[model samples]
Target: MAATEQEESLDDLPPSAKLVFKVLEYNGPLTQKGIAEETMLSARTVRYALERLEGISLVTEDVYFADARQNLYQLTEPAEEFTASDGEEATCAD
Candidate 1:
């Protein structure tokens, strides 16, 4: 999709959700702990954002290879398309 269109799609997301998206984009797949650390969000906050993102079909989680206790998350195609937009540089809250 075009960048502008992508940005528009992201317009409904809350700031926390946007932050999770950016972290996933920059770091590739990440565990919950990694996301919390990278985004400087509390673990509970990250979980909440991930759940919200997943509800929108924007993010997905999978089992981590080395650690069964952890799940790695990454952006779905739609999310990548959204973040690629040019109207604004997406920012994640620290």
Candidate 2:
């Protein structure tokens, strides 16, 4: 299906949060710093996005195995699940 940005499952989230979700969706788990670098968002914004996603159980937060001070972020399910749950369209790659 040809999906538009508005058709994404993260419609209820801010664009930055959706972007963070997409980043994790495609790149697997990454540290907050990695996410900030990847999305070009500020650290604070990334934190907010993670908090939002976690609140809905759409994302998971874990301590980085290699780093004691940083946290890793990743999606809880496949891209399709996010869309399917919201009755929207999956907008990310496998």
Candidate 3:
């Protein structure tokens, strides 16, 4: 039997992975070392979290122009943050 097409949400990821995701979401692109330092996680742990995020297609990996030896990590898109005027509820179309 084959697996289903259902996808996992951010809540399904581990705490470390969630921290890594948030770090990237706020700080923009960063290298594995940078993420490790920012998240205060061990290199091995960061690598593991990154692998999980990659598996879920949450974060993207790109070659670092300044240093080819490292890869930069960033979110696929901006985090879901929107502010409405006068406390109005925002819509997707707005």
State the displacement of the C-alpha of residue 25, model 2, in Å, after optimal TM-score superposition.
0.8
Looking at model 2, the pairs that clash are none
Q: Give the alpha carbon lDDT tens digit for every residue of 1-94 in model 3.
A: 1232137767888999999999998999999999999999999999999988887778999999999999999987634456466677756874
User: Which is better, 2 or 3, measured by TM-score?
Assistant: 3
Per-candidate total of colliding backbone pairs:
0, 0, 0
Ranking by TM-score: 3, 2, 1
The numbered model that scores best in lDDT is 3
Name model 3 segments beyond 4 Å from true: 1-6, 78-94
C-alpha lDDT (0 to 100) for residue 14 of candidate 1: 81
Q: Give a tens-digit lDDT track for model 1, residues 1-94.
A: 5664455445587898899998898889999999999999988999998987887678888999989999989988755445647777666556
Q: What ordering of candidates by lDDT runs from best to worst?
A: 3, 2, 1
Which pairs clash in the backbone of model 3?
none
The candidate maximizing TM-score is 3
Off by over 4 Å in 1: 1-9, 79-94
What TM-score would you give candidate 3 relative to the actual structure? 0.76
